[model samples]
Target chain A: MTGSLIILQPGHSVVTDLGRTKGPAYGLPVNGALDQFSAKAANILAGNADNDPLLELTALDFRMRATTDLLIAVTGAPLDLTVGGRESPQWEPVSVRAGEVVAVRGIRTGLRAYIAVHGSFTVPSLLGSCAPDTVVGFGLKLVEGFRLETRTTTAPITQPHFGLPLFRLGITKPAFTTNPVIDVTDGPDVAEFGDTAGLLFTTQYAVSPRSNHIGLRLGGALPERQLTSEVLSRGVPVGAIEVPSRDELLVLHRGRGVTAGYPVLAVVTSRSLDLLAQARPGHTVTFRRTTVAEATATHRTACLELERLRQTINTVFGLLGIGAGQRWYELSPASGA
Target chain B: MAATTTTTSQTTLDIYESGDAALRVVARSGDAETNWATVHSLAGWLAATGVEGIHGAVPTYDSVLVEFDPYLTSARQVRAFVLLGMRQLDFVGTTLREPRRFEVPVVYGGDYGPDLDRVAEHQGLDVEDVIARHTAKTYVIRCLGAPAGSPMMDGPDFPVPVPRLKDPRLSVPAGAVSVAGRQAVIAPAVAPGGWCVIGQTPLTVLDAAREPLVPYVPGDELRFYRIPAEDFGNFAGQFLEARP
Candidate 1:
């Protein structure tokens, strides 16, 4: 069936997916939903695959109207959710009639939110993904009056339902708060920090306003280092906490460059990366070091719990009518392990 | 999370957990060889091994950033495997493979290359002579960095180092071939650059939609040939753009 969503007042939104994991080798960054866990939850609740195209609203004032009857689910940072001027619950499936207006107001807490429908967005794809990557020039970057057309069938309209406890930092939360604690592990260049590595944990850093999807600039004390010769520019990963000579520390996010020049003192854990996604500008963040074993343990627990929750939500909201081509999303907890 | 375990005596391989989901295998010391071919070859060889959870290895000059899955492969396992792979690289020998070369036609000097005269002046040489020195031989693509698909390659032999721009240009057009130090780079997009612009190539080196996408990968070769500025309009690479 053909249906469309008209943005009444677009406030920084883009059509995104789980992003392309395979394209990074071609000098592409892994461009996807910053808060992947919540995006997947939104997709599952909307009766779509976890990697289905999502209208990721980064700004707070996102308003749209349905041109046709639509089954949708909103997740991530809880905002002033409304459907046709009535308050709607976050983290659950809901129905909107034709001409019904749905709006999400100034993000109450988190940095972004996900609006997933029970179908795929009829946008262009690049390098085998539909995610919008400004760095790589893929898909559409939505603006005001933009229309998100979709190819989806009629999904069962259910009464307002609630999802499981929130997923964050390897723990389920009844509600999310601002400036959550983040866990990190040693980076490839962690040894270079030497004694200065302690500064990564002892000092608290605030997310600077300059922060965007590309990186989170943190204002903090410089991590001390022995003045060694220049190290060659190397590949940097998502969540790598890179420190330049005199500038602020930067945490490479989902939209990070494929490689960089500075040394990375620490790397935020995968589970904590989702938490980092929710961190708004001005949010104070502190790092807690975790061993590879500990990080792996929590990452596994988080993935298993998320998979179980996805199945539960799919059963609750009913599966999407996707075919063999788009039947299942590859949800490898550890990069296709 | 632990101390590095070297697998070979010739060089130490430092394999450690990079982030939560990846392990990086680095050659701790510089190889006797030049231009980082050994490290890049090691990365390619490891990628060819088909080890579990090893997603991709992004090689810089001297290190391979190996991304692994913590679920299917532990850091210890990936590290050990990568160490073994390094040892295998030693046994098989990372021969300097022949690089694919493309003759990039450029319009040197004048408005197309704003800093050509300055670069020639800095080196105390005539502009035509500088151009002759640059186009003398093929340059090897070392790494694509600084900007996306911006190929950094070995520069032509010169008596002195080429001076960088005192101030960076706000908008450097794509295909602006420039040089500094012992290396050269072809600007792929409009970005602020401080490199001394020797010429402007009409050929597109970096396009996301091209069949091969980028014109040069690591270990490829690029050659510069002087072309009349009007001849720049003859090539299709000048008009190629990413359709997204």
Candidate 2:
């Protein structure tokens, strides 16, 4: 796909994919989409690979217009999506004609959303990803009035023919809960916190206003430590629930730096991290304890589900005479052509 | 969480599960310097081996965080890979490649180094004395972290550990040479930081467009030399290179 998308109303949006996997060794933080599940779903719906670069829109109000016909899908955060001034459903692929506008706004239940087009966005890749790192000011910085190009080679599908029938995927709407009980496994230093670590599960935490892609500073009963010694500055993983000397617990997110000095009491499960990403400021979250094996199994299941869905999509499209790797817009030019 | 240990020669590597997707390999028993060397050696070994499903191996002072795809590699499998790398590191010793040295040109005291006087006053010394002590010793690169590609080097030979700013600056300009406790770092990019910035370098420490984005590796050596503030504009955006 080789067309451009013009931002009519820019929100806090950035191009994201499964960010640089090898850059962390050089002190780079993984700056991918916060909600991986939704980002993948959106990409799959738009007939792209799971790791294709797409727009990750944080809660604000986003509006964009396409210069060519494209298949686009919006997923994550139960937001109101409007296409060409008409209400459209989220999570399903929708064909938009050239010059049609797509707006996503009024995202009350969650904090972020994913918008994936038929092809990946063309952005400067650092360490092999377009995901922007706000901390170091690296990668593409999206702004209002900026035009983003994609790899679409198809022309605008203006002519409507009965022979060409575009089909959208039938998917169950994902739930966006304001108050969610997240699952977490005990971290390596959980024992150092002593009895106070139990408070993590019992007390409800409200996502603090200071939360960002780097981390989520939760406000609630703080976890106390028995040993008041400083932890060594070492490599810390994303989703680590670190207990600082004082104040509330800070949960590391995707944009977290490679190493940190705080003590980690628990780590959010990989599957639960997708749900945690949607948590906005003031959203209540309670963590439940789980084993690593259980969490691992859950994540494996999710991966398999996505794989099955991908296969089904390919089969359906193939049966409809859309050749392998051919987009819906590239279907043999209308019957009378 | 269960901690697994692998003994290879003198170094003992302990693998602890950071999460389902990440495993942390720590030096069980060693001094800070020895542990850092052991950790970094393992990081280098892992990269050289290119183990399957291993996403990234980040080295710290005494630990290396190895991230992998949970779906493709299990925590147990990751532990085995780390143990295998540890064994390979024992054969190679700590040095994977020869350490390169760099002469970093820095302008101290003024708009470039706003906290130079503060550091000197806190240590009960003159700004010139502080600058002299900082440049007296050659430091080794420990690791890189914080604002991406920022090189954390062994501390300067200061009488006392310098304290970090109580309140971190919202944005520390790129190429800022900062210090905290016994460690020093050059802010490779513009980001929020809490370290005491005593000087600034005009050379570009990191650039994504350039191949080998960061010039120095973990075992590299660096020596900072004083430069006149008037020469700052003469070397702007110059890529930092090691001595030929």
Candidate 3:
């Protein structure tokens, strides 16, 4: 189907989907929508599948012209939005007429926002994900003149979507409004770091401006060095907060290097990791030690909630006459070995 | 403690819970051969097993990290599965595949390898001697990381280890071969790194559009040949490849 959208002012936006989760052996991380929770919500509102491609907008201030009438939704890290010069709200589906402009700016709360269009974007993928990763070369970064194709045909959105109750029922709101009290557990090096061990929770660390998709470089009280030399290099996880010799604490994110050399202090819990992704520079962070049981429960609750939303979306789409979109979720065409 | 099983002379197999999300299996420790074997054997078994939650393992220099869907399987349960695999692991019978070696053409010792003189001087060898020693051994792809498909390599530990540049270059162009602390790396994409530059290969180390994506994969072997700088443009598309 030929549906197109033209970029007016591309402000650090890239086509992204549920990231590639299976290629660490090939030197790739599970890269996807950094804020996956929001990514899913955006898709639901836009009447797309959970893994459909979305525009991952960093720090907002983006403008795009809807060349075709398309259903769209903006979710994650509240950004001031406007459609055709009119104030638009987030967390709800928005219908834009052909030639109408959908603009986003003034990202006050979070670092990233997901803008999903009805019927996923048909961007070229590397190894099955359309997510643009700086590390692993795939997909194109959105620029002013670039055009994006839609997987479905452009049928004008007529109904004003009332999906607020669905959102309320699904997806628990994060506790911390301004500063996230992200939950973390002891890392692999928990036992080895000797006496002054609880520095990760005890000391206050702020997100440094030097942070990027690769990692969040933090400027905080330097963890006392128990060892003088580097350890054996090994694969690091997404939320591993690796501590080098001195003050800087690096919390590896979705785009973490496949392997790491530094000793790890803590690993952020799966649910709270989304919050960490939104912790922009200068944002204060506090760590709360959580048990594996509690962490699993939290994740399970989130998954169940997302699942509920997905069911709700299924019903909504069925009523709207858009059958469940094709399976773009599978990472590669090759069947799972 | 993760149940330790199958003790070897050099290393032991152990597992660790990496965060709450996944489990890591250290098939073997320290030695590269044991580790490579453990990783391959375990990966092969797991892929064959096709367990619900076992996503698969990523190998490093001395370990294979098994990332899983925590919701479907716990660390304790995965450990039990791994232990079962360990029992079946015929370390003695597992044949190491004859490595596929690629001969990469490189232009050594000039602006491309700015630190070549420094590397030679520090190792107490002449420029030609340094080049000879570097080109002599076939390096194994130890790890694939940094912008994907970039190979962190290991070889016969250099008689004299090449030291890293005190200040790393802001951007080492793609296909630059460099070494530090007895290991080598071919920059798959232009990015800043600490490894001392030795030479540049005109070959596309990582072209996303390329069929195989990367010219080489981990566990593969590669050797470099000195080529004239002017000959770089002469070699277009994929470079001459040699497989063992």
Chain A TM-score for model 1, please?
Answer: 0.87
Best by lDDT: 2
Residue B148 deviation, candidate 2, in Å?
A: 1.1
Q: Give the per-residue lDDT of model 1 (tens digit) for A101-212.
A: 9989978678889999877688777766787666445578677778889786443353435422222222243255676788998877777778988888888889889889
What class would a CAPRI assessor give candidate 3's docking? medium
> DockQ of candidates 1 onward, in order?
0.49, 0.70, 0.51
Error of 3 at B203 (Å): 1.6
- lDDT string for model 3 (B1-244, tens) is 3234656444578676677776566755766687776776676677678889777666676566777766787666777887776666755444446678888888887988888898888887788888887788888776676657677777334567776677877878888888888678788788778888889888877767754467665667888778989998877776535564
TM-score per model over all chains? 0.86, 0.94, 0.90
Clash pairs of candidate 1? Answer: none
Candidate 2, residues A12-119: lDDT per residue as tens digits?
888889777877888888879999989998888777888899999999989999888776889999889887776777887666768889999897798999999876
Off by over 4 Å in 3: A153-176, A325-337, B1-11, B28-32, B47-50, B91-95, B155-157
| Best prediction by DockQ | 2
- Of the candidates numbered 2 and 3, which has the greater lDDT value? 2
